[model samples]
Target chain A: MMLRQGALALAALALTAPGMAQDAVRSPDQIVAAAPARDWVTIAPQDLLVMTLAPDAEGNPRKVVIQLIGAPFSQGWVDNIRTLARDHYWDGMAILRVQDNYVAQWGQPDPGMGIAEKPVPEGLKRMSDADYTAGSPNWLTSSTLRATKEPQVIGDWPAPMLTDPYGDYATFREGWPIAGIQQMHIARQWPVHCYGMVGVGRGNPPDTGDGSQLYAVIGHAPRHLDRNLAVVGRVVEGIEHLSSLPRGKGPASYYADPAKRVPILSVRIAADLPESERPHLQYLSTESESFARYADARANRRDPFFVASAGGADICNIPVPIRAVAAE
Target chain B: MMLRQGALALAALALTAPGMAQDAVRSPDQIVAAAPARDWVTIAPQDLLVMTLAPDAEGNPRKVVIQLIGAPFSQGWVDNIRTLARDHYWDGMAILRVQDNYVAQWGQPDPGMGIAEKPVPEGLKRMSDADYTAGSPNWLTSSTLRATKEPQVIGDWPAPMLTDPYGDYATFREGWPIAGIQQMHIARQWPVHCYGMVGVGRGNPPDTGDGSQLYAVIGHAPRHLDRNLAVVGRVVEGIEHLSSLPRGKGPASYYADPAKRVPILSVRIAADLPESERPHLQYLSTESESFARYADARANRRDPFFVASAGGADICNIPVPIRAVAAE
Candidate 1:
């Protein structure tokens, strides 16, 4: 229905902030103030990947979860992912590469273990940084790979589609930056990639990323990847792990040693596992009233802890929160 | 004697770059290339923090080392830090806060539980982001903290420090765009706060960060803290452990539930430990001849890997390396 009516109809139903429904960018605080319960949706357990790491020498597991739901993530291979993340699967994994201000990647069981004998040229892992130059207003572009979507004008009319909004300035709907939750009126759609966002780690060499090797955005929101990479989920829990790999020693942070790789015991899709084995999960609905309040607190940060309000917020800077749902 | 005679000698050195030998903006590569052997100091193991996380439920003892040197982290605290790091003395610690685009920090073990807390206020905590923006660049005065230095003569006298070198063509030193390094050299030294940089985490009031709680920068370096905070060290490894923490549900990433604190087993000074216990250590000496070749390679990127060279470098973008050395 949203696709049929187009953006104009949906604009009226769209939210500018969490619960505030006035829908003006200028009045972010007021918009969430009026949102209804119809805005939020409960995330399905099947859509979740609760990542629990085995205890380090201290016997404390660094536990964090990811909610993977987009297209490719849900497409069949998720079961293998569950196995990979479960039971010390990534133990002694190798940190394949770490490109500065770009990514710090960790690969499965071993990367150098099965060498083809020849140093087959590592395929190009392209970054938008290659195309963009400082002081130039032009958008970054590349001929290498189309990882992000481009604006298209179809039949002389600008056409937009609905997508899951994770990063950038996604206004809250049901506690997630959801698309298509409102009255089916808007035709516009774009995906945002902000910090703490997670995308499947893939290799240009083909099928290199089985989702076992993953990464999180730690610096600025490398937003250009929204349409390009299969963003399976967001790091609902721990993201800092991928962000700080001590900047790597070699060209990329390809740690030269076998022992340097951070091990991943396993990754499990919540829905495939038994109830007792599942991770406790809960996320405030972006479309709900409570969530609007949360986004508000994060947007301007009017709390006593803040000495001054930043006044304006870039959608990337705003916080999207998730928590472990406790057993009743 | 060096400080007094250095002025005249620098006048002669200035002839190399912009008319002042001492006034040149030397890149890290250039700085290391030209620096005398005395300018580089071997990091004493006693000053290093051999941080080892206790075995998690799976029993992987994730071992890492952190070093605190220069000011604040001094020889006096050697014994104290040794106990804190090597012996599992300060285990099961708490993460103090997760500052956006900046840092994620963890505090020391509880006092009654057996560890002594560092009483200093968190280094470089913020009062407002505006201080970084339009508010008042001059508000730097009146504070007890000293200002960092950047020296360059505009028309034969030093000009104002420009943070952006390539974007702004800031002053040059030994062929590098420089500021704070010089400031610190003149005894007006301030901390260098960039990614993976470490500082103590503190409470409501700034300056409350003691050695007990530690933080590592996961995002853009918060340069605002250069002089305001006592930067203890930089993360040699395992910064992902800090950056990837599920952002605390509350503001500043303070996890609302105490149970969520990612535990820290201990933080120690590396130098105090026995040599046999050290991770075979080495670093791409910034001052080494090989680094000069590497920096040029980076500056021009003539390698087959890069089709086009960036032709420029950012201070924060430069990679400072640390390595595990194997004895010949």
Candidate 2:
């Protein structure tokens, strides 16, 4: 069994070897050798939601993805709410509920006003008993879980896309894990909750109103949310800010006193900004050498103090580190 | 059967009437009535630790609790962590780790240098993993599990403390609908993973390290932590903050880059401060009238909107609201 596990692990890693070899360090060309520019498409400004709140931890707005209303969205009518986020669209809203553990929502608290918050007025009103609604109409690709796969998926993340046995236990991709459980069929995809992933907040009334208020997944990754909630986007950076706010003193996190509500100064889509004004950025290539190295550093974590190498890692624990892309 | 459920619920409510009347509303005795004066105790400054980070959502230096070596401490840690807080120290620190349907943790990520950035070297360590390490050398609480429980631990929070109505269903805590085989004689008391609960985080060694990185029961409230970890506090106030942090990137949340780590400014015990420096905090005594209303609000949740209230509130979902004390 051990040998088989090992061999299977190695077999899975072979897929990413070519990609890792050419570019492994943290540089502008990190994944340039491995991916075509087509892989770097920018998200549409309307499709992206930039949620801003008074500075808490990272000193930036709490951002999320706002996929368009589509077929996947179970609450049928909501699709008509043509969203245009940048111009103070979802600010100064009321929190519908703060479902402890699952989400802390804020937006149009009342159903009457909730529907009004959407651009297309009478979208959809979910039943009180509905489970979850989908976000976008994008069809998932066959190999979205991993540009490649690995031996086993301890959890949802690919184990090690690229590996250097003597060095790191990973098979490189665009700096993301690509190993494990490829056969299990991860192609069935949706936005799985992780810290900072955003979802439209709803209640017993799943479609009573297409979500106008939103909540960020701030705790453990709520995998069950996959194919369920309309997950718009994730916080590429500055999650610490949102995850440390003072909780609501009222029902469903609608602070008993409005004074407790955090304020929003502004929210903007990164892509909407002028080319010279966007924040410096670069996401680690899921398939890269620096990524593998970083993973190794984390897997073993021998920072002059940690005595043992846990040799294991949770997928949610492995966030694809984003950085300020260097100036040419 | 329905009638019985209503009766039991009413009886449970009748049990908490006296405590609410004690709050004068006007004078409130300043400190005593703010929170249960008897329950209000000091935390040792030696045990205090603070964490400072701008989480994923906002860009602000967020502060949190982190304990050092000497703090699995029973009491007397700081002069007053939140001096203006009512309920005395009851509102000091709050819970942070509510994983969606999992364990909720509470502790400061950083308190002080030694306390903040640790696995502390100074505090007491459980001598061994033996089940008998008692809080006091008195009667040791033996931790065990029920042989058959189902859905069992809906993601880790303890099985709700429930009772059967009409003996048809095996109602349990966590406000879940359950059907199970009973073994009354085998009932054991373990610290349940209810929402807003506080727990300690240990290294793989289990007992090594100080309480620097604190978390809360933001998710489903993992019941497994009960009896396994030391639960020190709860989210008497804000919880949305911790649950909102973007998931950490890397192994078990040890950021791949040390710079990604949130810093700890300081942590002081609530008791260390002078009496005059305490916060005027108030809590709807879990055993009070407001509590009964709060509990009912959760149990039935007949909000004008809830088409269905699930009719059950999990132990953790029942928000234990906290507030600032109104001085006379």
Candidate 3:
């Protein structure tokens, strides 16, 4: 995943104008490739949750890497996730559901089928529904806030402000996609359910499941679930391992057959793993100049394959670039 | 997928207000269940493309049913698809690429490998860049046209009009999702790239693809691809067969090893099949009152599990409900 310097230099020379020869227009990937190394931020090992699934039929290892949401957004559930990983709570749990164009859910469900439910680790944070969104206390003075009170505002804020269907405005915060609504002087923000985002599964209201069960969005961005669920993190790698599983036949896509469930071999935080086995990953900083350009290029695709550049882009469409950092 | 009257009646009584008890607020699925049969429209057999992929490891039949685009949108490509299907152009072709969180492409690629490429049937239509979007000559007289000069406007047209990132407005047209920009006295519209949407794959500009190689959006709604690619149809059933395929290792997720490619057993128009073999399907009419209510429910989740309701929704989020009709 290392950026090729040769491709970067060539793309820079080619990025002059749209409607030029096919090879002249720099693609969004090319724009990201030309980004300076300083714009790349390394993810802390403590924030990485690595879950290992049972080997596939061919005996290939199956591992999924998740990047926990940072402070000021769903951190309570994030803390619980880290604790669960530390306690090996999900070590022997199974993937319970694979809903087509919906989600791939894992971990324990409510007990009924002969199997005894495992007791949750003590001191797991019990978060209220209000915890789903964080209060943006400093937004009144922020220069990034658009002045319009309209339902959707389109302008530059790293990228063109989205005509958000879920909130007044949707944008990136600390390399994470977020949507926020301003009510008078108060503003509340929540993580959105873009594809590959990992969320905590719960049963009914007043019962935000304590991160014992989690699921990854495997299809289109289900924005309806935004303020309804606790999005603890996002699957940074190995999503294919889950997304490609056979969909369940039971109602809500739960596996009807007991043997159909895929088992979780282990779950561990990267910091707990040996240094040699830890994953080295970096994400393009949302605040960096390169990300702004990258986001713009995504909104306006001047790439060779594209005949017309879409004048705008959905917030989810402009995914913050993440890449595996090769060891020196 | 049948409407259960018991659940329908129960949900009807529960549809009072937001923040009510969990059981009282009806979910979007329940609203669709309550939709009258008259509100459901039967898809024409000719519009259905039945693609049979090679059986899986367990020998389970993998049949993907695609509903081709109707009149006034990508019809040229749609006609070509019908011709290709009738001619059995994809019988021995293999899935070309499967880029995770992007697309699952299938068809014959340009010859470079040892295998000779299949000769495309004659009478394949050559399309222009202008055909990517259809002129909305009747838009000014349409009752659904919301009058607003703002970048984004939120109001009910079946559902709340989307704050489209790709265009001035995004809405549903005859059961299909679309976006368009108002340019002075003219408006041009194009089919959007939602999850499961199929598009014609082309090389450079003016190629517009000859309806030979095709791809299905297997991830988030890649709105950036709108107006950039010729959208011909959407996979209405068995998308998991394609979406769950292992990612290809080659550039653009193409299969590096030709052996890994899944072969297409056959591709045919559903009308070409025997009456007993044809799949019967119906989609909720986007213009129906039930559809409007369903779209509203999707935008605002008043269900018990939801503490807060998202005031609006992406057009793709409100998927037109399609269900199989049991054989009589």
Top candidate, metric lDDT: 3
Tell me the docking grade of candidate 2. Answer: incorrect
Candidate 3: give the clashing pairs. B22-B304
Off by over 4 Å in 2: A1-48, A54-82, A86-88, A91-102, A112-187, A205-211, A265-267, A289-300, A326-328, B1-328
Question: Which stretches of model 1 miss by more than 4 angstroms?
Answer: A1-40, A50-64, A69-111, A115-196, A204-213, A216-230, A237-268, A275-280, A285-296, A308-317, A326-328, B1-194, B205-214, B218-328
Q: What is the lDDT of residue A6 in candidate 1?
A: 33
Better of 2 and 3 by lDDT: 3
Score each candidate by Cα lDDT.
0.43, 0.38, 0.78
Q: Specify the highest-TM-score model's number.
A: 3
Worst 10 residues of 3 chain A by lDDT: A1-10
Identify the CAPRI category of the predicted complex in candidate 1. Answer: incorrect
TM-score of each: 0.45, 0.45, 0.88
lDDT score of residue A26 within candidate 3: 76
Lowest lDDT 10-mer window, candidate 2 chain A?
A: A161-170
- After superposition on all C-alphas, the RMSD of every candidate to the true structure, in Å, is 13.9, 13.7, 8.1
Better by lDDT, candidate 2 or 1: 1
lDDT of 1 by residue, A65-151 (tens): 677644322232344455554544554444455554566555443345442222212332333321111121122122111111111
